[model samples]
Target chain A: GDSVTQTEGLVTVTEGLPVKLNCTYQTTYLTIAFFWYVQYLNEAPQVLLKSSTDNKRTEHQGFHATLHKSSSSFHLQKSSAQLSDSALYYCALMAGNTGKLIFGLGTTLQVQP
Target chain B: ETAVFQTPNYHVTQVGNEVSFNCKQTLGHDTMYWYKQDSKKLLKIMFSYNNKQLIVNETVPRRFSPQSSDKAHLNLRIKSVEPEDSAVYLCASSFYEQYFGPGTRLTVL
Candidate 1:
């Protein structure tokens, strides 16, 4: 069985500060992809970033994540966090062409101004 | 900005009652999926349909079923709702990256 794990339950940061939400996964499949989805209050979760290449960093909307196959981690990071960046972040895993996703317990990011 | 749409943002029903949630996607995706988000914000895939054919079915209860009229629509129906079924039901469509619709919150009293 494949599983994703988010170590942090809730991460709070002051506006403009650096932020990181840890995400790791365990899978038996060799070809796997990772994704980050953000869900705001009363909104649907959207794709923030995704990666399938190992050790390659992917960035979108100022958020960046690098998938490291050796470590089995794809931690999301941002240099400067904004107030609007507050949301529930989920780390997902999908194997090959299978569209079904295995999601982790989401991490709620709260940015305070 | 989401192309996927779900009807009835929220629904309140009683135990043993039947409930159905409708989902439609205009993204022209071949695959549509149903996901359940529990109170803890843990998401789990319940069902997935590709080209109007069932492809993935997780170990869900027999009372739960997925109805897809076509590639753009996938509806979920619960034969007899249970208190444990009270959660957010999300509809998504994808060929690779999934696009989600605003979830429908279900409350079973």
Candidate 2:
């Protein structure tokens, strides 16, 4: 079984501040892949970052996340949050042969200027 | 830069009617998937197809079916739609990372 949990429902941050969106996953398969997707209003979810190798960091669009197998987490981080960075973020896992994604409930980020 | 395309960007239909949505992928990938996003903005996997074989989500109702004529086309059909079925349906393709279509917004009244 594979599942993802992003415990934050909403996060409001001031511009230029640091931001983190917590993501933790549970998987029976040892070989698992993690992904972070960003979905803006009226648009489909787009892949922001992904990583399969544990302990390695993956980054895109000024956001970075490290897959730490020891902690079973791949929390997303941004050093300087911008207003345009506001969107709903989802953490997903690809664990089995089906290639089906197990997605988190999502966390909404609101960046204030 | 888009690899997937979905038809019927927006649809409003009666609760008891049947509706079909089309999805096509040009990424040359063997796997395609359909996901549902509810009004709450929660995403859930609905169906998947690989090399023309259907893999449906166990929780999906029998009334919801997937039809694939070729490796690149996956169409979704919903029979006797319910108000709860109103949501955004996204089509995606996977080649290590999944690429998504713009999505089709369905409104069941």
Candidate 3:
């Protein structure tokens, strides 16, 4: 069985400050991919970043994450937070041959001005 | 613009009532999925259909059934809804990456 764990329930930071949302996962299969999804108010979750290569930093929309296989971690980070970054972030692991994505309980990030 | 579409942005029903949610995608993707998001915003996959064929069925209740008429449409039917059935149902279609639709919020009274 594969599972994703997000330690933060809620993270608040002032705009223009650095931010990090912790994500770690466990899987039986070696060939697995990790994804980060962001859901805004009243909107569906969208793919923020995805990675399968170990230690490769994937970046999108000013957000970056590096998948570390040794640590089983793919932490999303932003150099500077924007007010628009307030949303629910989910860490998901895609495993098995069925294309099932196991998602972690989301972390709500609120960027305050 | 939304590539995937879901009808009835909101639904309200009583316990023991039957409910169905509709989902369609225009992305021409071969696989479609149904995910449930609870109040705590935990997104869980319930069902997945690839090319109108059931590929993955999670540990969901027997009351839950997924219907797919074609590759683009996949609907969910609940035979007897319970209070704990209240949540947001999201439909998604995937090629390499999954794209989700605005979910249907279900409230079982």
Alpha-carbon TM-score of each model against the true structure: 0.98, 0.97, 0.97
List the pairs of residues colliding in candidate 1.
none
Error of 2 at B101 (Å): 0.6
What C-alpha lDDT do the candidate models reach, one value each?
A: 0.95, 0.92, 0.94
Model 1, span B1-109: residue lDDT tens: 8799998899999999999999999999999999999999989899999999999999999999999999999999999999999999999999899999999999999
* Runs off by more than 4 Å, candidate 2: none
Provide the lowest-lDDT 10-residue window in model 2 chain A. A94-103
Between candidates 1 and 3, the DockQ winner = 1
TM-score of chain B of 1: 0.98
- Over B71-105, each residue of candidate 2 has an lDDT whose tens digit, in order, gives 89999999989999999999998877898999999
Q: After superposition, how far is residue B72 of candidate 1 from its true place, in Å?
A: 1.1
Clashes of 2: 0
Which tens-of-lDDT digit does each residue in A11-83 have in candidate 2? 9999999999999999889888889999998887999999999899888989999999999999999999999
TM-score of chain B of each: 0.98, 0.96, 0.99
Clashing residue pairs in candidate 3 are none
